[model samples]
Target: MNLKDLLEEEKRVVINPLQDENPPLLVVITEGSTTLARALIYRILIDETFGPNQSIHFILYDSLNFLAFLESTAIEITACAPNLLEGISYSADSSIAFKDADVVFSIGRARGYEFTKNERRESFFEEYIHVAKIHGEAIERFSKKDVKIITLGYTAARIILQFAKSIPPENITALSLLTLKITAALIAAKANRHPSEVINLITWGVNGENSLPDYRYAKFRDGKFVEEEIKNDVWLKKNLIKGVRSASGRSWYSRSSAYALADHCKLLWNDTPKGEWTCMAIYSDNSYGVPTGIFFSFPVYCQNRKYKIVQGLDVSENLKKYMKETARIINEESSIALNAHR
Candidate 1:
């Protein structure tokens, strides 16, 4: 479906169960790096979903850098700063904020960087696992009574897998089992309380077929949890790689390449024919049309507010290899991040 159609579907699902007394409130917690983009997107979505006068509150937690960005943008949204700490303190604060919340959007953890490689890696893992615990605790607390949460990032999965691998075989099995159980529990809680809420656990930067677990969560129905496989489109795959690599890299080259590529792709798309798909390559000689099952984005018409993926024109072998390689690098990085955190 097209962007409009997907949004319309979301609106239908969200608004159907509403009563005149309590209007739904969207609470968003975003990381510093993507806060600007997220804020822009949130503004568009909120305007579309609840109109201009509706109440929308944005909470920026553990994000001083993002606060500056938001201030510069001048988007009128309420903001909050939550105290972050190791162990149980973080979870307590999250639970208090989540109480009486209709929909909660959480963007994973944020921490300042260290200079050395060892320090950086250690810091990253420590922050990630702690954030996972906070996330799990929050879900366990609020989801029990029917509050819906859409957590961004595979923080829980990363933590569970890491903890499982580091300990003994018995601990591994126990932790792994607990991870699966918690996932099912959250899904069940959301579905049981608010049948219409879309409770998704998504991780950015993972691409290709291997990234399915990061973006797609299990669906709860009939008192059971079933895995739902969500395929990423070409645009999402490309942009996610660029975003992750740039954000993680130490040098300006990686970051600049990401921004340049995105701008170039956008320009290319504008020049291409309407309803046609095109994938651009920096290493290859030309752009190519995307194949079926190969996620891609194309200009498409949204009827009744639904967007659909459109196919692109055909290209050469070299371009295809480049695209595949780019996706491979992204998936590899994601795996590395997961393993390092574990």
Candidate 2:
């Protein structure tokens, strides 16, 4: 019925169905401004059938606009699922938010309609990077050691790389599943099939403009090879990346992106399909000749809350060159973030 009640509930232990022993409540700390945080929380609540090793506990953290965020989010949740109020709470304190957290989701920041590209980038680094560092340090110092950090938003991929020293690279992942989902939908549209009918669509590179779609392994879900109409290499080469980038820029993107991110998290919480994999941005270890120590999008196989980068599928010389270029751009962005932090 209240935030206090939810906070109280957070201290209760629950028996894990997969394990005989009792575990502390599943603590999810989400950091962002109003819109993204709202979408993420609502999507997660509606999709309660999946997530983490234990029961879900949500802590919404909005430092700059906690008053408005707290009011609006509470109203939204009450309208959506009043009964679930016992599982959600709001926090303005980073320590309280991150304490004992199992998963950390860092998302959007406030942006103005008139901000220039360079201005937005500057603001993003100033706000998001600082917030990410706070979450990183808090998670490292207070939360579970093996906690997973999932980030989404415009430059979500670049933000987490700033946490290199605070969180293990493997524990931090940036969700670019939206890119893969869009790619699948675009390919499906070519054949007049629904997006879900496409399988194994992968992305290589960073999350933003530099991200590349790799359809070489994509196929129809019903065990049929993708028709040349659906996989039209020439058409894809011309339009796929541009279309995806444009889609991500549209006003309604956050809602769809949030939905995809929630589903992707579910896959991480449970498992991807027996033979299928998903795409995500994780710290690169030179997979496919990407340089080490930068976050890049790649095909990842997820199970039991762990993921392994899918390795050793062939990359064409052209794709390899493009991938390397993407890595370079991300690495440069990472360096800029580092410098800005300094």
Candidate 3:
């Protein structure tokens, strides 16, 4: 037998049957580095499965046209971070890679741009807009009706999950999720302070839109993850510092994006019918009296291997103002992109 047939035979013999049965296909579209994408694929294979049965088809579309940008990122990651991704199989053929993509994660500009937090806000807006342009172009390339495109980590409840992991396992009889601006409205039964006092559930010491993704918190109340009130503030600055201390040098975007991808994969592949919802970044079109044709973040759920934005949540005046501000930023950024190209 030829090598290709031999590999196929090996796959059939080794991989679990449940996993081999129509495994979900996940694609990561990034500018130069596939470090985070590969890491995500590893996590999906190892963690998403219930028992021994775990497998997934992964693809990496290194969307870099400039050799310098590609070469620089490739060198930086390899020289600084080794084996950020060790073991995961991905297809090379674009047709096969994206034949049945369930999730598409676009990190930033495809041609690649060095993103150091700019001293000026306008510069940062340019960076953000670059990401939006790349996302739009990636879809235009793969153009799948069902594939959900996300902005790195904003589309995920990552901070909440981190906060959950921070709490004592014994204390977590119920559930706990955190908002971006986490305020301690509900007191933890085990917290040293009263369960009523406000605590900084999560304090974002870092900059960027992550400081403001429209995400929700879930606390285990009645046996399931029920959505709860989301308040914002600074209570976890020290904790965040400690976290950065414990593991430094990695970019927050990659770390959070990987987790976000894992979360999406888990829901799309393993979880079933209940349709548990999570916040996601979706393009808005006055869907709920918002803006027309701008990327917006909203709560969403995955069902039958597909995702949709959840609707009819109460929108306060402050929330509308915030949404409007975000829309303005996105629109202005798009203008910047168009102007630069012109």
Candidate 4:
């Protein structure tokens, strides 16, 4: 499929608010291994939904090794300079490559810190906050009207907390949720510059089971903020860790327990409705294997050209606990950020 094909009147499917606005350009910023995967998926989806000839701009940062790996793939992508973090130093021009972007997908953050395990949390918080501010500023500067911004990664709250300077678990979770809302607000503000323009913010992540003892459902929901939860019923053991092992071609037994727990929850919940949900799982045995619980985005569809959260059915006590712990981890990360700000 090509860009022209996607913009065709016949191939277009109007889902609510997302109308065929001349096959909007997609801009992606990514870090680490997932960058390649997301880039491939984005290209395939764009081609399938629009057409092959459509021009999509992908902005990647971090890990040149991974970039080389991605270059070997079938997806045709262009590389931009200075990297995401480095680009921050040149914020004035960060958006230059994204001048025509209609949709922006951002993933991961720079991970460079050598501190005690306890202090590692604090360092990560500071790093992400700095990353978000730079990225946010760039978006505000370069984005065109009617652009949709989708942010991947579950660390938004942690980053915010680092900016705010308080590490309470509750506060960190609140900040994370707030970051999502703020991201939406930022995009809307940019779109408002033009008449009749709209901005959509789609945030994605895994559904943490609620059956665990350390579950922080309230925090994950961002203080009772109703959001959609997409459930995957495939047994976790069967599907979850396969990606980890496959991605690195090695056994990551240390993370096997985490993967097992996450997978077990999948069996406990009913499957979310098809077409309403987007699901992804990984089985890798590497450093990446440990962060399985982080929430990430998947290509999704809604009544509008936008994406909505998938709502999951009621879960069991055991699964609920696991899910809660996942949420807690998310909250805990944010807490580190909060502490750093303080």
What TM-score against the true fold does each predicted structure earn? 0.35, 0.83, 0.53, 0.42
Q: For model 2, how does the per-residue alpha-carbon lDDT over 194-257 read when each residue is reduced to its tens digit?
A: 9888888887775545557787778887777664545466677778778876665454566776
The clash tally of candidate 3 reads 5
Which RMSD values do the candidates have, in order? Answer: 19.0, 5.0, 11.8, 17.0
RMSD of 2: 5.0
Winner by TM-score between candidate 4 and candidate 3: 3
lDDT of 4 at 61: 34
Q: Give the per-residue lDDT digits (tens) of candidate 3, residues 138-178.
A: 34455455454444432111211122233221111100112
What TM-score does model 1 achieve against the real structure? 0.35
lDDT of 3: 0.38
> What TM-score does candidate 4 reach?
0.42
> Candidate 4 on 1-342: residue-level lDDT in tens?
554432221211111222333443444343423433343333334333323233333443333345344333313322222111111100113445345455444443522111234645465545666665554444456555454443333455234223323222221111012122323333334333221121222222232221111111212212221122213323223333233223222212213222222221222122323332322221111122224323332222233333333343345575445545544554565455445544
Evaluate candidate 3 by giving its C-alpha RMSD to the native, one decimal: 11.8
- lDDT scores for all predictions? 0.32, 0.66, 0.38, 0.32
From the highest lDDT down, the ranking of the candidates is: 2, 3, 4, 1
Question: Could you give me the TM-score of model 3 versus the true structure?
Answer: 0.53
Clashing pairs in 2: none
Candidate 2 vs candidate 3: the TM-score winner is: 2
lDDT at 30, model 3: 48
Candidate maximizing TM-score: 2
- The Cα RMSD of model 1 versus the native structure comes to 19.0
Q: Can you give the lDDT of residue 328 in candidate 4? A: 53
